[model samples]
Target: MTAPAPASSAPVPAAARHAAPPARAHAGAPRWARPGFWAVLALAAVLYTWALGSNGHANDYYAAAILSGTRSWKAFFFGALDAGSFITVDKPPLALWVMGLSARVFGFGTWSMLLPQAAAGVAAVAAVHSAVRRSLPGTAGHAAALVAALVMTLTPITVAINRDNNPDTVLVLLLVLAGWLCLEAVRDGRTRTLVASAVMVGLAFNTKMLQAYLVVPALALVYLAAAPGTVPRRFGRLLAAGAALVASSGWWMLVVDLWPAADRPYIGGSTDNSVWDLVVGYNGLGRIFGGSGRGGGGGGFGGESGAERLFNDVMAGQISWLLPFAVLALVCGLVLATGRARPVAAPPSAEAPVGAPPPAREDSGARRDLPGARAALLLWGGWLAVHYAVFSFSSGTFHPYYTTAMAPAVAALTGLGGVLMWRAHRRARAWAWALPAGIAVTGAWAFTVLRRTPEFVPWLAWAVAAASAAAAVGLVAARIGPRVRLRIAAAALATGLAAGLAGPAAYALTPLGSPVNGTNPTAGPAGSGGFGGMRGAGGTPDGTRGGLSGGTRPEPSEGTPGRPAQGTPGQAPQDAAGAGTRPEGMRGGPGGAMSEQLIAYLKANRGGAAWLLAVGGAQSASSVILSTGLPVIAMGGFTGSDPAMTVERLQGLVSAGELRYVMPGGGRGGPGGGSGGSEVDAWVQANCAAVDPAEYGGQDSAQDGAQDSARDGARSSLYRCG
Candidate 1:
């Protein structure tokens, strides 16, 4: 009676034996929605927004400007354009189109331009969370999401790029979405999911051309391996995925192909080639191989040296911090897959016969616990590796930013590794001792690197040491007890996350030094103020007059009682053409007051069309000139070409009346080559005789009085063309 009848051989009811977890887990919501999650998200948002806004304008501003203009839209998409045009078709236009839309909605302001990128970054974090949830258990998913966000937050380059209006941020987000879709398609064999993957790949192409295709094959291969039988069944899904990619990317290709050859610019010297030639040869092949006829700009590590360049620029520059975690995850995955470290099973039940022990589970509970985790890890890691390998070994110039799309994959792999370590070591003592130790060491290393400010190499060394130490500690702790190891691993992860954030936080806090202090204005300006002074008369110490005439010269003040004439002997003005222009519409007035004079000059001299050539070490001038209706060109050495040569060329146009005026002030040196000591003044005086006296009279009298009082120091001169 006491002994229970032998257990029935019949299987337990499916419902009674196992109940699926709720679709919505308590932890599914971010800590921000919960008090903790909210606080974290809010703080991060604020920090990131401030950093994004505060960053100085990057070099890509030129590209952004070209993209933002309504007229440039077609050129933005197709490679066929005028020869020697800076606005040539280079990158795909999808990102620019998004940015252009944002600019349209919010107006062409910096904040508006960057808003899309910031939004993309935020969405990426959410995407990572969704991806993890779809691919792993609830706990691991949450961990992975947290890790992804932290990784992004901590990466300085990521923060800077996302803050700017660049295509990389959008590409990265699209890639992450595609990755998640690929994982879903593999696990569920859903056609829609596969199609989604294809669409994302297409968007990625639009964002950055062919670089986005790097991940597709890797994802497909991993999926094929993970679901061996499903591939044949889902062959149609694969084709659909391919179709989606083509649909999304093919339109641009076709449009570009049909574009007239005369309209296309010689990008990377592949001009005179057909649109298809430009797309595949220059954009496609030139991007990965060292071919002069292709779009390769002779800048990247193309040819046999590509591998080295890839490691240095793409990997080390972009994803250096994640390399350690990636390596560790790879090793762990390979070991687990090969059965080298078989998961330990629960001991046999107490009632088992003396000679018989219950059979070990075929699908280890570990695998069931994180059903798609291994597959996801393999897919993402392999994608990144293969993507880099393709580019690294190719003969095309690869920019550091190109690798940014791989960051999400690396972050996901690292997160998976962390989750696995935590699962294996569940308690504090087993791994926690090393947690503090690793943190302290890594933190010290970080401090050292910070002090040294080593860009890529030093950072890599410390990251490697930290990762190795953590892995050793984790493995040892896991062997002792799962609980102990988990606690330690969790602590270590928290420490690493915090450590990662420290660099970006500190960088964000630091002020961007002035762009003007350097010898060249292209170096960036020093002070942070509206571009008023640079556009106004007081922009320079000398009383020279300057204004935003697309290509007109500064109007001269009539006559200052004490101030010497423009062409006074030994006082020839130096050329100051490339300094950025002031904010749009601002002009310096009498006694260097903020005058509408510059704006008036722009209107008067531009006569409907003139290219504003902003010189000096000021960005404000360019900003001001652009704000005017006239097409503005930066004259400063921003183009890496000689500013003097540019000025000479502009002068030739001005002499030909193709360009009418030249505005000199804005803290830039005035034009040189006046006859005698007064050559400049005389030359300007003779040429500008037709300018309205009234225009110079107001500022001239005041500046004259000021000069009379000072009697020695040279004041800025503002001259207008006759």
Candidate 2:
């Protein structure tokens, strides 16, 4: 509904410069009234938001943080992990802000907390659809929009994150929204839309730190080159947008840093109390290069895999299905769909044949010859390439699920190229050949990708390859032979697309069919499975993690692959991933249905201290805290490694009679948790009496039923302290 953008080389219109594009206006138009649009949205909403309450508190760490945040504005604003504000979650507070507000309004529970992510998922799908429609033209544009939206929505990793309370969900939405705004800026030659685009990126930064900025380079390039302006003017406008970006993302970081440290939670991921340290050291480069920079305490991606991890067994199934196709699309679109000679204008009295296709989209190959289209190329292609390269090359600690960021960029390029090539094919031009080439390339690549999961769909890959080969053959025959009907080529292309889409569609549907629980959850034919379940596939020792080079396996219970260590009966070490700990909420950690006896024991002995008991980290404490509404300090935050309370500080809490009992499950490098709780854990072991959890009727309750965190829960152990 935006005012028709003038010629790409023309001067900007004043009215177009002020108003935002009416992207949402399309929802009410006749085009939307058609069945296809509604069908896509309806299916997306069902997949994203249905059966919302099943995940419980999704990830215990963030769920506990939400409980703390809702208690007061300070905790909410600071991303505190508890009401006492012991220490904040490692990242910024924007994601917690949305989740905490939902928990506050709806009253904290699994469903209320996860609702935001589901809503975000739907919004992301709609936003991508809108972006495609606005950037491409014609019915091909609408068709591409549907395909792109579905491709992104059904991506296994996107589906996995969107179904939980993960910050990645919000981050993905914000990034795609920026891409849409940038597209509008180019179309209208409006600097204001560019401002909006920058604002969105800044907000994304608040959601996930430097990871959100991966696409910023492409955004700047697109706006400067494609936006209606002289070179100097475009540069000036981009400078202003950059200023806006810095101001928006920096405000929260400044507030957190400038706030008196003693009055708030310690910044958990940092070795120092400084928030900027947490950003630049841990969440930023430290993720790529490992070793939390100047901040003590170690970090790294582990092993020498580097960028090869992207296509490895762990990640390939989740985010890579469409990656090959996207790359192919971008190259084809750039070379085949650019620089077409402008068609000679037809006379006013001339009428085209009834069966002839309509003129190409207004922004299709002819207009794409303008600088703006080339800028679009840089925006989308750059987004995909930068993220892929960084994710592949970074030596810092990374998770399999982080691929959520790449989904939108890949989806956009796929849609753009598909529409252009489809339009280009009608003209019988040399570039039109890119269509068949694309089909063949994607089909061959897909066959290889599918080989990794042969057990999943034994014959499905062959079917896809055969259908795609046929489509390519049909299209070429239509081009070279007089008797071949073009309709045959169209049907063949449809069959190929449907065939190509089947594997990922099945993968995405996995989570919907089964309960997903773990940090790096993946979707497959049967259902969702944790990253732990998939790890033994990559040449690592089976059922155990290989140690650093020049080392034998870690000491049993010392930094185990999943749990940090094992303690006495009823005890397992906390999750040990440290500041890089992938918080899986209730679904992660050594989870179990804590015994009723343990709950009663804490309640009966609550008189001496403000907390019933303090444990190693969120994993060891979340279920108890949630079930009993009692204060249990998760001292290490997510991984027990956050120096949240030094040994001296904890001793002070005990001396003041503000804390009493200590849980026995926490320790250094010994199973499930990070390393921050060692001093106190050691102090308890040396000074306190061992309290047999069995005496309290906590007697191996879940141990008898099941030992896994996903089903029953982790073992529990307790210590008596004075």
TM-score of each candidate structure, all chains considered together: 0.63, 0.82
Tell me the spans in candidate 2 whose CA falls farther than 4 Å from its real position: 1-34, 292-307, 343-365, 368-373, 482-484, 525-530, 533-587, 590-594, 664-678, 685-695, 698-717
Best by lDDT: 2
What is the Cα-based lDDT of residue 699 in candidate 2? 40
List lDDT for all candidates, in order: 0.47, 0.66
lDDT of 2 by residue, 1-722 (tens): 34445668876564343222433435544464247766877777777765554444556667777777777677788887766677787788888899889878866655567778888888998898877765554465577777788788778778777877668989989999998888777767667878888899999999988998998988888776567657798888788889989988889889888998878888877778778887888788787666533222331221244566666665666777777778878887776545655565443433545556555334335553323334455688999988988888776666657888888887877887776777677664666577788778777766776777676567878987898899888777777655655787688778767766776776676555433344444555321132333211221333222222211222123322123233322122222211112122223445333555555666787676867777766666666655555557767666566677667877787888878777644422332344365566677777777776455654455663333322222433466677
Regions of candidate 1 where Cα sits further than 4 Å from its true position: 1-44, 55-57, 60-89, 228-230, 259-270, 273-278, 290-318, 337-365, 390-396, 425-451, 454-493, 496-603, 606-629, 632-722
Clashes of each: 91, 31
Once model 1 is optimally superposed onto the true structure by TM-score, how far is the C-alpha of residue 194 displaced, in angstroms? Answer: 0.9
lDDT of 1 by residue, 442-541 (tens): 4454444343334322354466456545644554544565456556655656656566445434443221221111110110011101111011112223
Model 1 error, position 626 (Å): 3.0
Q: How large is the C-alpha RMSD of every model relative to the true structure? A: 12.3, 8.6
